[model samples]
Target: MPCCKTCTTALYITAPARCSPNGMKYLLPVRLLLLTSCLYRRLTSASTMAAMWPKVILFRDSITQYSFKDGGWGAVLADKLQRRCDVLNRGISGYNTKFGSIILPKIITKETASNVAMVTIFFGANDASLPEINPQQHVPVIKYKHYLQSMIDYLKAIEINEERIILIGPPPVDEKAWEVECIKKGSTLNRKLAVTGEYSKACCEVADTNNINCIDLWTSMQKVQNWSEFLADGLHLSKKGAAFLEETLTPIVLKKLEYVGLQFPYWADIDRDDPAKTIEAYNPYCPSQ
Candidate 1:
């Protein structure tokens, strides 16, 4: 009897040119089974590969929120750590350490902390606001220090130790430039460089007491001839300022992740002829096992 069209197609694909009709009938089922198994293995292996990439959480205020903007520091870090780790931004605009401490636990729980390779605690810009001018945002410098310490303690409790934490203090403000913003909002200058310096100093003290790293943006930017250029509205970071931050933070991040390498083999190492060989080697759920 003549083979059916389905069988004929399977025969051409899976059997030799001289394959008998009976042989095609037997080979098709085995070939289909092997193909299905390979596909399943590839799917599971892809998920496992993704899970292997560590996470770097950027937990901060508007600076970090705006970090993904053009020329933003967060974008720079994301590019620098691509394939090695996932850079997650958890920035909240106008948030102070008091609110940040309250929210940190909700975001970084014990279940998810183990996967975090690094976390940046960047706050205090809003906290340093003058209470008389910006009562809603202002957090006392003393409370700010306690809040930061509490956050560090919480992260440690959840397994994110001091070595994996970095504190970024508030950046310097430009009174001349910021006054324009304050006027637009119907208020006199609500943030002052001197007040911000006080908070930044407190941030460094906390980092020192906890024995963790810190990026004193307030002091670092002022070292330049015209630091105000770094501030977009005499508060937020401009592109240049963001780049400066990226340059400073990248080295520390690299040091922390020195031992971690690329997640998988380079593309050139993949075997094109039998890709399954490479896939199976890396796949822990390979059927043969």
Candidate 2:
């Protein structure tokens, strides 16, 4: 939390000048000197003080992959976090935790980990697929738990600590509606509400074991009256459901952002007569300094 050295030094570069006649005569030269000095300091410390957008990675399955659709939950999040953070969609369709575990390292590497402010792990619906009907996407309950734990462990290894991670359990399924979709493909229902609840429970267990945050969508949606309206195809979220997701998740994301200020000064704050004075001294990295 300590301010960077470059910004700390920049703060003491000058004091406010008086508006006396002598001060006015030297104002232009003083402004140019201050600008030059500030530029030099910033350039010298570019490696550590360079501008970079902190990221919030949304890593999950089909539900997440389609979160940016018209009026989707991901789109809502992106809008809420416009300038403060970059919300990266790393969702892959039809992915179970097994495949997610295999590819997580490649998606989030050591190089990118430094700038990652947060990550949301959302999976389980696909893993809970009925093995007898859809063996390809179905994963055993026990292995699903293992895969979740492994992913959490791997993220911590790369320095994205548990504090920055959020586990989102699967939402409740509308078995009857999903069955209709299955019938269109010449198949019977391949998912059950009870089965998905098991995976959702397992997702929360991993989160609890690691002492990270969790969004138990499965339990939450089920508590609401007429929960079926929350889903589009018994599995994916409807527009109403996406709004609920935003309402639930936005508070948590905002809590994490309490200490993060806007990246740059407001346009109106730029001094018209001496723009360089404000521009050179403004330290987005260390607003307090």
Kindly provide the TM-score of model 1 when superposed on the true structure, using C-alpha atoms. 0.79
List, residue by residue over 105-155, the lDDT tens digit for candidate 2.
Answer: 999986567567789999999999999999999999999999999999998
C-alpha RMSD for every candidate: 16.1, 11.5
User: lDDT by residue for model 1 over 115-135, one digit each (tens)?
Assistant: 677999999899989999999
Candidate 1: misplaced stretches above 4 Å?
A: 1-47, 273-289
Please list the C-alpha lDDT of all candidates, in the order they appear.
Answer: 0.81, 0.81
- Quote each prediction's TM-score: 0.79, 0.81
Q: Candidate 1: which pairs clash? A: none
Candidate 2 segments exceeding 4 Å error: 1-51, 273-277, 285-288
